[model samples]
Target: MELEEIRVAVLRIEGTNCEDETVKAFRSLGVYAEAVHLKQFYSDMIKDEEQRSLFDFHCIVFPGGFSAGDYVRAGAIFSARVKSVLKRDLEEFIREGYPVLGICNGFQVLAELGALPGFDEDKPLADKPEMALGINESNRFECRPTFLRHENDGKCVFTKKIEKGKIVMFPVAHAEGRVIFPRGREEDYLERLKENDQIVFRYVDERGNYAGYPWNPNGSIYNIAGICNVKGNVFGLMPHPERVFWRYQHPNWLENPESPGDGRAVFESVIEYLRKF
Candidate 1:
């Protein structure tokens, strides 16, 4: 597909407040993008002209924000609605190698939908969640700048433009961002992620060394902050990349006036991948 031909859907529902920024990020890259309400996909309340099908877009992004007010364990409510209404469509979308990205709360939704750490290639969507983005280790909502080290071996479409081992700063804001696997299987799951090169980003300190506490933020397993599915078409991260698309958006912009923001490469890489499909 040509660059201009690629269409992106920044999917959202009630309380998903980050849709606008996500739409802007793609639009800034000169691609066709829109903030698509989930109701348009399966709800009968919307007008016929406003209704939309999932197949119309090349990329789908589950932007950040407390969906359904996070009243029932973060993304549980939103994920259930999607599964109940558009399960087949979502399964087909992933199976067809279309790109899917989830940021912050969206990451929780993917976990709730069993789309991340996608262990079974034959079954694109798991019947139950294999992982969880539980509450922060600090037991409070964390909002601050974080450093991430790219760890994928050029497999994740979202990080192709980023060099391995390079540390980039991306701000994180979430209450339930810690990544955890099934009980007694943490080590086993970590091995699978490393073996498949599914691990995309890991928390790191300013010196580029893996550390603890504030450095690791939510205390994700193995300091992991982001990951991709086995097929590399789906990715989920806890940070808000759309919030820092430009250098000025960085917290230390004045100190590094000439450097391009790290988040831009993420969007550019995905768009570049779609152009080839």
Candidate 2:
């Protein structure tokens, strides 16, 4: 598909403050992208022409922010809404091999929707959530720069442009970002993630070494910062990639200004995948 022919939907709801930046990230790549209200997908209150279908876009993104104010868990409300109305469509979209990217609060939604750790290939959506992004171990909302080491071994479409073991910095802002699997199955789940090559990114220090606390930020198991599904088409992470689409967005860019930011490679990778599809 042509770059301009590929359309991206940056799905959002009230309190999803990062949609604009998400849209900018894709548009900067010269692809068609827009911030789409969640209601426009299944709400009768919307105008007929305003309604959209999941199949309308080649790729869909769940951007960062406190969706539905993160009232019931970070993404519970939004996930519930999507499950209630658009679950089947979303499942179909995933089954069709279309790309789905989620960031921060968006990552919570995918987990809540049972869309990640998609161990069951036959079932598009897990019967229940297999993991949760809990409150940070610090017990407070953390907002700071974070370094991540790309770990995916060519299975994740989102990180294809990112060299394995390469360290990249993306800022994170969230309270509920710690990733936890079900009790008694943590080891089993982690093993499965590694075996399936689903672990895409791991938190690291400036020197690219695995570290703890502020480096891990949310205390995600195994220092995991991001992951993709078994098929590599669905991806979710805790960092805000859209916020750093350009070198100027980096906190220290003035000292070492560059055109493309570390995060830009993510968008470029996905867009390149869509072009081949």
User: Which candidate achieves the best lDDT against the true structure?
Assistant: 1
C-alpha-based local distance difference test score of model 2: 0.92
Q: Go through the candidates in order and give the clash count of each.
A: 0, 0
- Over 4 Å off in model 2, which ranges? none
Off by over 4 Å in 1: none
The TM-score that candidate 2 achieves is 0.98
lDDT of 1 by residue, 1-277 (tens): 8888999999989999999988999999999999999989987999999899999999999999999999889999999999998899999999999999999999999999999989887677899999999999999899999999999998899999999999999999999999999999999999999999999999999999999989999989899999999999999999888888889999789998888788999999999999998
Q: How does model 1 fare in lDDT? A: 0.93
Q: How far is candidate 2 from the true structure (C-alpha RMSD, Å)?
A: 1.0
Cα-based TM-score, every candidate:
0.98, 0.98
Candidate 1's clash total is: 0
Instruction: Residues 164-230, candidate 2: write the lDDT tens digits.
Output: 9899999999999999999999999999999999999999989999999989998899999999999
Evaluate model 1: give its TM-score.
0.98
- In model 1, what are the clashing residue pairs, if there are any? none
lDDT of 1 at 151: 98
